[model samples]
Target: MVSMSKDTPRLDPAAIVTSAMRIADAEGLTAITIRRLAQEHGVTPMALYRHFRDKDDLLDALAARLLADIRLPAPTTAPWDEQIRAVLAACLAVLRPHPAVAGLVPARILLSEPGLTLVERTLALLDEAGFAPDQATEIGSQALCSLVTLVATEPGAATENTDPDTRDDVIRAKRAALRALAPQRYPHILAAADALTLCADRDNYYDLGIEFAVAGIRGIRPATRTSG
Candidate 1:
């Protein structure tokens, strides 16, 4: 650990957030305490408290930072469904790398500028799709929730940071366990053991989710109304 000195640079809000994210990424969100962050940054806990009133305040800032990292999809002339998919895909790209934040974001009401910006852009896309204000709001809420669910429940989701060898061992164990089931009693599990253990590749997994969401949204439109 680097020792603090008289010449040590003063800690700033951005630096605090950055260090917090690093710790969360490496050791999960629960490990990100003010003391831990201060220790990592070679500062005292009081230094972090200067910027954030408490752990919740620090977490709120961390959530904002995660949202800020997401690059919003560029405006395109594509159909609204395509635009929605693009927006969600961008969100997934940002959240997947920081899976810990994926778990944290949904629990908090995001009042930060970056979080509000994402919500604004999403609502705008829904508006462009011709939904009424209330419908757009509901759809936007559902879409965001779906994005969180996808990251939270997807297989191997929680093991992203685990050692490759350990992950492989877990997968192998699951596959073997499924294969060991009685054929007559658990025929489906035994038959598809390989598929049960392996997860879809990232693109396929995300694309399927986007397609499902878009299809559901499309289904809600009046049958006589044609999509552009």
Candidate 2:
């Protein structure tokens, strides 16, 4: 059977990936499929197959798109610590808006040109801060995991994705459930229930997560040695 209509816009990797991301953001990653995207675009699975061999390949393309959006910082004279922190922040900025697909990044970070560049730059900074090659690679992996997880687990993520009034209701219901616990038995939980349920300031929450990640890299930096 003929796959594409004469008037259908020619599908490309960029168009396919962008549509998949839109579906992922609004409906979650599991909702994306070659058939689903093809239907939406008035094309056929065969047309999409020209760009993505399967769902896994399409997801890899999505991951690469995320990496490509990262604005890697220029080489700077600043301390490695400062520059590394900036790199982490840049990655977060790109991934934060697409938490649904942010998790795809860590597994694919070494698989694309942009991702390879990011990994190389990150490893070089770690080396500048005194980590050996192996140590820097391991540390970069850990940092990648942490940054992706940061966005993926943001407080009330799915609920917060709703309309404002609905989101507030979800947050309030969660807070009430936590606060309803026996104060005497759950005093500490009650005390921090709001923070546990939701972050009042989204930017502040991310700022702290970035600082925590940076502090972790610094905390483990190699120490000066002395003569035995």
Best by TM-score: 2
Judging by lDDT against the true structure, name the best candidate: 2
Considering only N, C-alpha and C atoms within 3 Å, which residue pairs clash in candidate 1? Answer: none
Question: What TM-score would candidate 1 get against the native?
Answer: 0.86
Model 2: weakest 10-residue lDDT segment is: 219-228
lDDT of each: 0.78, 0.88
Q: What RMSD does each model have against the real structure?
A: 4.1, 2.8
Q: Model 2 misses residue 86 by how many Å?
A: 0.5
- lDDT for 9 (candidate 1): 91
Q: For residue 77, what is the lDDT in candidate 2?
A: 95
* Candidate 2 C-alpha RMSD relative to the actual structure: 2.8
